[model samples]
Target: MIDLHVHTAISDSSLSISEVVRLAKDKGISHLAITDHDTTKGLQEAIKVGYEIGINIVPGIEISAYDYQRDKRAHILGLYIEPGHPSLNMLCAPLVQRRKQASYEMFRKIKAAGYDISWVDVQKYEGGTGVYKQHIMHALLDKGYCGSIYDDLYKRLFQRGNTPKTQGIAYIQLEYIDARAAILAVREAGGIAILAHPGQLNNYDAIDEWVELGLGGIEVFHPSHQEDDRQKSMLYAQKHKLVITGGSDFHGFYGDKPIELGCHELGEECIDELLQRIKR
Candidate 1:
């Protein structure tokens, strides 16, 4: 089985590249993609580890993008990316800075809220690619400021809506490139751009628009997707003659539930089709 979406410590995940490879091997995942958010920095290390561990590691990335026409944000997954693609690097450069700036602001807000935390505390969890909200939350949890990662404490502080006590501590939103640009960057990098987890986006209405913008496929199966969502995505893919892919979206110990490396996966047939698309 193949999982096309995954994140490592280079992004918001708790697991390192080597650790993720080991867990994927243990879970019997034959093929995997280290689709870290906004960066491909981990792919080289993951590819090296996968070679030693007998698993196929596909270089990939997940770009956070916005659709200005629809006023919505979505994640675009680039599978089988060229690690040193100039276009990918160009697109990610600004994002890296943007993420760091946002993280700095978030840390300041949290510190001002009287939490015994600092930017240095949050930076300790980052793997040098960028700082994520998860890293900040993890730091807060580690310092006993929050009981659970996704509990009320998290919502109160980071989520948009909160009680008066936590209202001023809300998360700062980061700027993102348009989804069209993300899809184009993937194409420029010689990778297939797949819409990631439409169910989570709740933006199926914009699928046709995305296709027009050069989206090559859809994430038909995901940890966050239900059976009905998978069926809907399958039908959509069939209708559009698009490749279908799935993955665990693994981010060890970072999510609400226990997300195993290969808990969700693409069958051999789906993998074959996706591979064919990449080869084309």
Candidate 2:
């Protein structure tokens, strides 16, 4: 299988480059892409390991963007990007900063709510890389302030906690570029942009609108997507002439799921079509 969308430690993923590559090889993945969120830092080591293990590692990144006009959020996955592209790097910088600021604010809120958590404690969970909400959640759990390592972040940290008077707050506002802007940026940088995990978005109407925005592909295969959702995504892709992609979204040993690289299958035809589209 050619799994085009996986995460390494660069994102909220727990898997390191070596472990991801090792798992991919074991899973018989002929082609793999480590599309970590907002950063290409893991691409070098992942590429090196892919060379040693005979897997084709496509350089990719998952960028978060929002359509304020339509009041929607979208994730654009750029595949086969030029790693040294200055424009692409410039585009991702603000996103990283926004995420960091939001994380720190969230941490302060938790601490103010009488939780034995601090910004330093949350930073410690970063593993020197992707500083996402998952890291903050894990940090709180580690400090015995929360119940489990895989706590419901949206509920506990974002909403269900105490009021802002007793807690610091950080709401995820629309950041950087919108979906259309991200797609255009990737196109300018000589890369194909795909909608990553549309099922998770839970807004097919919005996706249909996105397909009209020059989105290059759709991620039809993802662990979180049910069979019915997968089928729906495939139909959408076929109807829109969008390239189809898939991945395990592996975050290493994050709970019960193993970091089985190509655990989610993508058809050979899907890979072929994607390549053809990129060539054009």
Q: What TM-score goes with each of the models?
A: 0.94, 0.86
Cα lDDT of model 1 by residue, 5-40, tens digit: 899998888888999999889888888989998888
Clashing pairs in 1: none
Worst 10 residues of 1 by lDDT: 161-170
* Model 1 regions more than 4 Å off: 161-168, 263-265
> In lDDT terms, how accurate is model 2?
0.74
RMSD of 1: 2.0
Maximum-lDDT candidate: 1
Instruction: Predict model 1's lDDT versus the native.
Output: 0.84
